[model samples]
Target chain A: MTPSAEDAAAGLQYSRVLDAPPELVFDCFTQPGHLTHFWAPKGASAPTTEILVDLRPGGRFETLIVNDATGATYATRSVFLEVHAPDILAWHEEHTGMTVRVTFTALPGGRTLFSLHQSDIPDQVLRPENRAGFATTLDKLSNYLHHLADGAKQ
Target chain B: MESMLKNRPPGSLDAAFAALADPTRRAILTILADGDATVSDLAAPFAMSLPAVSKHLKVLEASGLISRTRNAQFRPCHLERAALDGVGDWIEDHRRVWDERLDKLDQHLAELQGGKEERDDS
Candidate 1:
């Protein structure tokens, strides 16, 4: 479904200091080759899936995460509305979707401050604790990305 | 958010998640989980008054994390462990989902590394 990625949803911040430079860290996020390393964790078999990305303003992006074992897929596709190099990349994930704004600012000693701030969703309904789940999921992503940067050096 | 999770054990998932989300609620649950407690017993740890404790209890009760029972004029609050099974179940599912993603990443990285080494050798 085409969900609108709006900024109005309560925002979330997930930050980590990647061992790589800002450009390198940014590349992994924007490039498919690098994305497959840190986007989602390992073990999900989505062999019947495709990922596409055009890292530019007004670019189209699409990806399908399918689990063949379970015959499930969470397909999300959107357009890249803006890109500010290694500093920022903004895109509309899918209405009722998530708009992710990832920022990479250089840190001292060649490290990069990686932050993925996503916003746009109404109150936490049903199971209200999803608010905390968001934080944990982001934390996992931060660690996953951190290890990716570390592994690159070894 | 986790609210999307359906087909979970009764009030179990919601109780655990909602309880941990707030410090006051978490402390309250922890107190009850250790043993059944009266309203005054629940109120002792907090700086807040009985009414505040009542409000927190209302939230917990609505979530089915705790049950308030009558004993003479005093109502004792008791923990419902069955209502918290969702916590463990939800967490495990979440773990499995992420673990799957991580596995794919490992394979992708190895392939990238292999390709790079071949290029370097050439």
Candidate 2:
């Protein structure tokens, strides 16, 4: 599926079809027990040490991941923006000023098509007055980089 | 994700973030993105004085976001492509982490269903 204009401006989008029902996949995001099982990257663990999931609009959703190789800890403190059970979940990450939206579409065979869209890369860095200019400049910068890369190949 | 980004040399990404925080500095980078510009050319867009613009340029240079040529008469400011790439790297890092996490989720779901199947068989 095509990403929204804002997401296409400066965002990341990912989709995966999982072998689980929509409710089960949704539960994996809202429930702390299920979230802790797979909320971390490889070589890191989301230790069930301090996970708080308040499943409602404006509620808190936090997770702490510890790097196994370096013994470092990364904490995510975000506020839920939308929480529709068995369907859509979205949150605003406090540290990065990014909004993450996840949707679960139930498939025919009881599977779930999970989609994630993350945006607002320039939110924290740019002021409201500068957003349009910043976005346009980012687009220019991307084009310039592409031009440079193309030049380097010759 | 924080740890992964921090694994890079400290202060590089932090400095880029800080450099991009200023509106004027960001505008300056935008100008440089189009083509290299002299200090006078950069200062012409804003009402700020040359020295004021120079101060901002100093910060940008320190952050490695932009560089100035060693030309004595006219040191044109050039956007450091690598530093901007570093900012893009942050997003790339997040994408990679999410990719890995989803893989873990896939495995977790399999294990969970496998257990359910075993329970149903018994």
Candidate 3:
């Protein structure tokens, strides 16, 4: 076991193993051309524009993602917190109030496994209907927890 | 209720983040998650005054993370789970986007490696 784990506190995580080595994967993340090619959402036809990457502590990364349907552009601006080449890249986005930490692990077959963890995501991304569903689910969970507490007391 | 929605902070997510930044406020939310509570009930657990808890409640209300009932007597504060849940959903959206982008990265890398192998053989 390579001790692959995502911090529960982060609240968001995704891990995938790539066929390339860690170094190569790191370059793909850092390079503007590579990011322009892959950073857009699946099925998104608009090429990513206004890419900026300053790979250092306190450095900034800015990108624009255009929605095909509405032709709306969304901007993501973040300051790098940690940048360990070929191993980790972490950043905190002020506008979104979220911190994203990505870790690159080296596998035996020259493959790389990286996990992306995001903490404190902002509410702007959620649609109203989805938010309503979450509220109902939360109420259910609250009731369940309350019952558990009562059982413990008994 | 519609007025309350209108009164919600302009940048809803920004307000939500600011409201949840404090540990005390987060604890308040956890308690309310159990069930709605009055200001005094929320205050009793903390070593703080009713006014402090009330202030925190106001912040939560403004963030649309909690709602207070109109009843003047209890004015029970209920958890607005949607705001918190919305944060989770936001993260999930980004995770999905990353998954797609990373998959593309994998394919790009395979192409690069294949090119290198062909060059070496030739």
Candidate 4:
């Protein structure tokens, strides 16, 4: 189930289907090493230089993004609001007074429904650029996982 | 711990994130994000005095969100988006993994239940 509407008004809600198990998807997120690979998709403008996430309510969620050619970091921080294993994660974003909630659901047919809903955000994150950026990242994840799944077959 | 982006480069992620955790400090960053700002310019909006704004500036400085200048002691604050890249990148990573595992679980459940339904038909 999702949070109340009052809660969502503060953020953006997003969900996507993945052809994998919840456990695997959860592992992909919880495992820092794995995260570095697919954080940003190929041909995307931004690059993920670092990702450090502690698996706890008060634990840190830190990462770094850099320009690919210049290697200049664009942003970084460790924000923590709440975390429920394999289900939800809530955190504040870059002093924007907004919060991010990432939800995961296990659907039938070996598919996982993952959604990211950010609340309390304004036009900044709502801009088309931000959404497109995230969509690109998701596309990378799908492609990478598809490759991994294929490898398992071989 | 409270200092404007003086003498320090917006060099690392940890320091940057620590500085951004506060609303006041984040406000300072937002202002800096717009452009450069003097102590007075940054403090103009808040009800607080210049000293209060300076205090926030100190923290921002430590976090690499802003930097001071040598001229006239008017340390201007600047917004540095470089340090914030990690947040979005990390979230994207988590989303990817969550997708993978959730899909796997669904398939497993369907497999178990699918066999039961098939046997029931027989």
Worst 10 residues of 3 chain A by lDDT: A1-10
| Tens digits of lDDT, candidate 1, B1-122 | 22232222334433334333444765687677568888888888797899988987876786677887755567788876544433333344444554454445444544644543322210
Q: Candidate 3, after superposition: displacement of residue A26 in Å?
A: 0.5
Candidate 2: tens digits of C-alpha lDDT, residues A1-154: 1112211322355667888899999988888788888998999888776789999999999989899999899999999988999999989899777778888999987789897756544333322332232233466455443432322221
Model 3 alpha-carbon miss at residue A2, Å? 22
User: Is 1 or 2 the stronger prediction by lDDT?
Assistant: 2
**Model 2 chain B weakest lDDT span, ten residues long:** B1-10
lDDT of 3 by residue, B1-122 (tens): 11111222433654564455455777788898789999999999998998888988987887787888896788999886666666556644565788778767766786778854422310
TM-scores for the candidates: 0.51, 0.56, 0.56, 0.41
What docking grade does candidate 1 earn? incorrect
- Each prediction's whole-model lDDT (CA): 0.54, 0.70, 0.67, 0.52
- All models, DockQ values? 0.11, 0.12, 0.17, 0.02
lDDT tens digits by residue: candidate 2, B7-85 = 2222244445445545577778878978999999999999889999998898788767788899658899998765676
lDDT of 4 by residue, B1-122 (tens): 11121222333333343344445665565566567889899888888799888877876676554667867577566654443333334434544644554444444444544544322210
Q: What are the per-residue Cα lDDT tens digits for candidate 3 across A49-153?
A: 588889998999887777777778878788888899999998888777777778899998787878765555445554467555343465544443333232222
Deviation in angstroms for A6 in model 3? 11
Model 1 chain B scores worst on lDDT over the 10 consecutive residues at: B1-10
For candidate 4, write residues A32-117 as lDDT tens digits.
66555444333222233357777776677666655566666645455766666677666766645445666678899766777765
Sort by lDDT, top down from the best: 2, 3, 1, 4
Better of 2 and 4 by DockQ: 2
